[model samples]
Target: MGKNTQDGTPGSWFKITIPCGGKYDKTWLVNSIQNHCSVPFTPVDFHYVKNQARFFVQDAGIASALKDVSYKICDEENQKISIFVNPSNVPYSVRYKLEPEEMEQLKLTMNKRYDVFQQALDLQRLRFDPDLVDHDIDIILNRRNCMAATLQIIEENFRELLSLNLSNNKLYGLDGLSDIIQMVPTVKILNLSNNELNLVWELNKIKGLNLEELWLEGNPLCDTFPDQSTYISAIKDCFPKLLRLDGQELSPPVTVDIDTPYLIKPCKESYKGSETLKSLVLQFLQEYYLTYDSGDRQGLLGAYHHEACFSLTIPFNPEDLAPSSLCEYSKESRNMKKLKDPYLWVQLLKHTKRDIVCALGVLPKTQHDLSSFVVDMWFQTEMMLCFSVNGVFKEVEGRSQGSVRAFTRTFIVTPASNSSICIVNDELFVRDATPSETQNAFSIQVPTPISSSMSILSQEQQEMVQSFSTQSGMKLEWSQKCLQDNEWNYTRAGQVFTMLKNEGKIPEEAFKQIP
Candidate 1:
């Protein structure tokens, strides 16, 4: 009994059950529960949470005032059963959970109500109306400037109502809408289809409000700016839960109209490089983003050959089936547009023993003795020498020997002829733009003893590190995997800065060591 332990195991259950029905008035917090954790649920149970709604069908008066509010309920097979048909008979205790989307839709709908409320107030329509009625409203229907007063009074009676009807009117901002959205535990269904307002900011904060639909159409200033598409895209990218957009059609993607070189706008010095290639790239992106972004493929690499010499690389087991790859780029190198019709160049030369292709995992994850091998890349018809850019070796655990690693990159390779490489699939259209015309090899300072300590990045090394974002994740991705334990030295800092600056994402501050 000196060192004893208790046995631990999962307990058995007699039965497993979940509800399944499709009714909006079910008053079940389905999405809230689902979003919180969905793996444990059966689909049938989730459906029941959404469809079997519990809403008021009738109401009753307390002080003989003749108040009546009716509620309805549906069963598993979609049959409507009345709840509060007779105002006096109330259920013992009803179960209901407010959804987040419903709250959002309610929030948007309140904006419409506020505007309508303002209009009715301005018009001075105080009595129950026959003509000015836009939709069903309980207390403040067709009243002149009575929204605030009506809401004040209505808040005294019913509590669950989160949305109001104030469609089609003039309101400066959707104020107090946040209170309704935040305070109301249960509210869904908002309709803000018509109004004269701009800049709705506060409604975005309702963390888990079930907001499925949003109607912000019929606003004049919504499209006042030409760059609205960029703005919208940026916002939607941030708010992933936004389900629907019931506004005026979002602006279409735009292409740079560079024909009016005479009508140039102000910009920084970065545009001095090949603007034609940039424009082409922008056009390609505008045309292809939807089809491109849907899958796990890497993103677009623009002018990589002309500007960065960053060769794309793939890691594979060294079973004699993978192509050697490396990158060539430089952070210190100034951005210069080189080629006019920039395109990827892949040679279909026959593979040879000397054919050089960069490989990964051959280098250990830990830093090791660095070495260089001038691969006589064997290709069809001729041989070309391929050099590893900033090559380094690493010693990994559980592995027998150390591995080699260097970025696949852009460099001056002396090809045998203009016909030395041909596109196996797309050679017919590739013009014979020799290296002198189309290529931008890495900028190497000549005749100087190699500053092994200076940590100067070749154009290829810079490009490989810079282009790492699209594939690996971000600047810190591959580095995090590779540099788990090592401390950053001055050379490492220099190399890190060179990679970041070339990427054009982080500023020069990234080059400095962390304090």
Candidate 2:
């Protein structure tokens, strides 16, 4: 057959021309293609001759991986065999043997509004227009006794399909849904109501879809839900950006902040700090993550002070979601949530190199995506700086699960010497990311500028300020003001302010502050 065959008959089952004289096991070679397929769908069956092997798929949808692509088949010896697919031959299921006239009649029955074609080329042949299908497409193939054949057609012709109405159809299971969605990732609104599907489990099949609206009210699956709320939550969990489901609009998720807004902002650029300070902070983090990601916790011992404290907390789903006892770090983890007292936490996680190394040993090895790093820096004092780095990290060892999680590490660094700094405190927080975020985790992000501004302090720091105020008999505001002016030195602030008062330069109104 010619390279560009448009007769609509699928060519022979996908054949891989292997190098001659190599006695290869056929069964093992063909089975690997299913796993190698981009979507990783199962094939109907596969067979092999002496020097060639072929995979038979039930429909074109299952073989979507083989279409318009060159697939490599590797043998036990690490030898590679390249398989090239025929570009023009349509590979629909054998059961869907409909002629051009019948497809046109089916399209007419569905209505002229929807663009239902037998194949993508049918648009050019029948309607004499191919470019018109570039934008959004609305297709209706409901109640026409459609099966894999119909879905294959949709997959073949899929353009920027915005809405698809397959309602009141005999469509049973959504075996080809993933392939069709993969073909047309632009589909945002889908109506599969009045169908025979009984389970909503297929929703998981379309994990990375950007579907905005989905209508499945009349399906048998609707009755399976215990309540409307349960159904909505399950659907939303699968597709986080889903705005409307079964005609009911879901309320957008709210981002609640327990900490005051001043402590955190939407982006690092919002954190007011100088460019020079930000650059230094970024440089430190870039190097820090390089060591940390390589599964060498002991290597980072120098990054921390001998008295440094490191605690980790993991939030489930949203930030407000109560954290699981053991976060994604490992199956069994003694996270910060389990520690009841500060002394116990410190004792368990001793502020020493050996202790930190032992503590991190239990966690899974990880590789952080440095490009996604968002650093926000604030100068607590001339010698001490506080910064938080939020980015995505993937597990590299142990479970080696293909999931990327968002992690936030806040470090309090003080100058150990004139040229270097050591971490006094390191607070780490982890959370499961939304599907959309994880999908685009590797996408390039504009580096957010970091800076410092006046903001709230931690409870420990607040208590220290209060202690200084009580001992000095100065108002809390004046005491904090003096301490900040003296670079957070408790003893120096008292002496400096006293000297200022003795010199008659101290302002009287500074001491008389509001509570």
Candidate 3:
């Protein structure tokens, strides 16, 4: 029924169990590989033992240290799908040509897997034979057409897979889909727009996607995509801000609407926030969010200074506002058009409290329009959405997709603590896609609605603040300080800020001045 792989190692020797109990053994694994292997699948005679599940595979430099491999089943976009070989080590090669017969076998295998995955996805409506997928599968050929009858089997079985693909297939109905999509972290691309999908949650797991694109034009989500802007928001959690939506490069002036309602009239006039000291607030927001000990720290400083007057420095609470100045969208600006911006301020408040620890009302997110950056923002204390081109912008250069060098940023409020707030800023300059390198970008958070003075402090702590402030010519508002310019030139002045904050020499109030 089957033989060993080219290396004479075990392949089909592995066990596969789908949700509906379609158990496949090593024979099946060998049959699929042997049948489909195209030009890339080099032939190397090897030895194997089916009973012991042991095999010695010869190497044509195809793969190495591969302990085992198999297909894994998973539910994606309301259909059961099959992912190819589960490997233990890094695959030796990615591009592999497929023989004509092998391609046919690949289709059959995927269709069978799709059927089982569907059964598990729609357990309530369709219940068919279970699956038989085992071991870790690496590749997932999701683009080919699967027979309609095979889809029925997936409704009964759920085989957790690494990569799931159903690019162009015959499938209908997209219910019971949230959990399956969430579980897949290695998914590359998914094309399910032609299928029927009504709920937004099915594709809400955008944060965890390792995906390059999602081809979703024909789904129900498109009609409601505009309304569910918050849920479908494209957050720059782990990818570039310049996204390719359906193969088209997303342009500037992007916006998203977070579902929270922030128009509640403040107990006091919004200007009450203006009472907060200016130098103190600016210093806190600027330094706290600026990247520390990084290349862009200086550039970040330049961003705040070169743009501060031109920039609308909206704080999280009333203190960030001017006590005397009336809060109004008085005039359009050189940098941004402000309509009482809320996102930037919230980030400032949250970081200040982290330094304070027990201070409540330190941060609160709000709903507002900041036309300057071309953004519509709504947020909770810890979350935000930039509802149009305003919040995102990009410039790129590349010869190809893999060689393309592009950059983008997504702004949000990380007001959970002082670190959260400041970290958001530092993260902006720091390379998100890589460990090294700096970026030119920034984001803001809203302030807390309710707050109180620090209760976690001892009298000694107050004394420390008093002593430090007295020592410095200026008030010791935040724990961080400029790295004497020299340090920033050599390293980063902001890096000194992080150190000082950890030492507790600076006061929590200083977070409002991070720049």
Best by TM-score: 2
Q: Candidates ranked by TM-score, best first? A: 2, 3, 1
- Cα lDDT tens digits, model 2, 395-450, are 76555465678888888876654245567887777777678768665432222322
lDDT by candidate, in order shown: 0.30, 0.55, 0.29
Model 1, 248-316: lDDT tens digits are 333222223334322222344575633643443334332222222222111111101112222223332
Top-lDDT structure, candidate number = 2
lDDT at 294, model 1: 23
Write down the worst ten-residue block by lDDT for model 1: 422-431
lDDT of candidate model 3 versus the reference: 0.29
> For residues 1-515, could you state the per-residue lDDT of candidate 3 as single tens digits?
01121323434222222222122233343344445443234221111222222222234333322322223222223333232223222112111233334434434444554534332121111112123122212122221111222232232233343334443332333322222333344445445545555544344323345555556666665677332222123221223232444554432211222222331113344544323322222333334333221211211221221111111232223344544121221121111233346654343332321122111111111111111123222332323212112221111212211111112223333322212222232111111122121122221122232233223445665555445445443333331122122111212233333443554644555444336
TM-score of candidate 1 versus the correct structure, residues matched by position: 0.24
What candidate 2 gets wrong by more than 4 Å, as runs, is 1-92, 115-158, 255-271, 274-515
Which sections of candidate 3 miss by over 4 Å? 1-163, 168-173, 176-188, 194-201, 204-213, 218-220, 223-515
Model 3's TM-score against the true structure: 0.25
Clash count (model 2, backbone only): 4
Of 2 and 3, the candidate ahead on lDDT is 2
lDDT of 2 at 325: 30
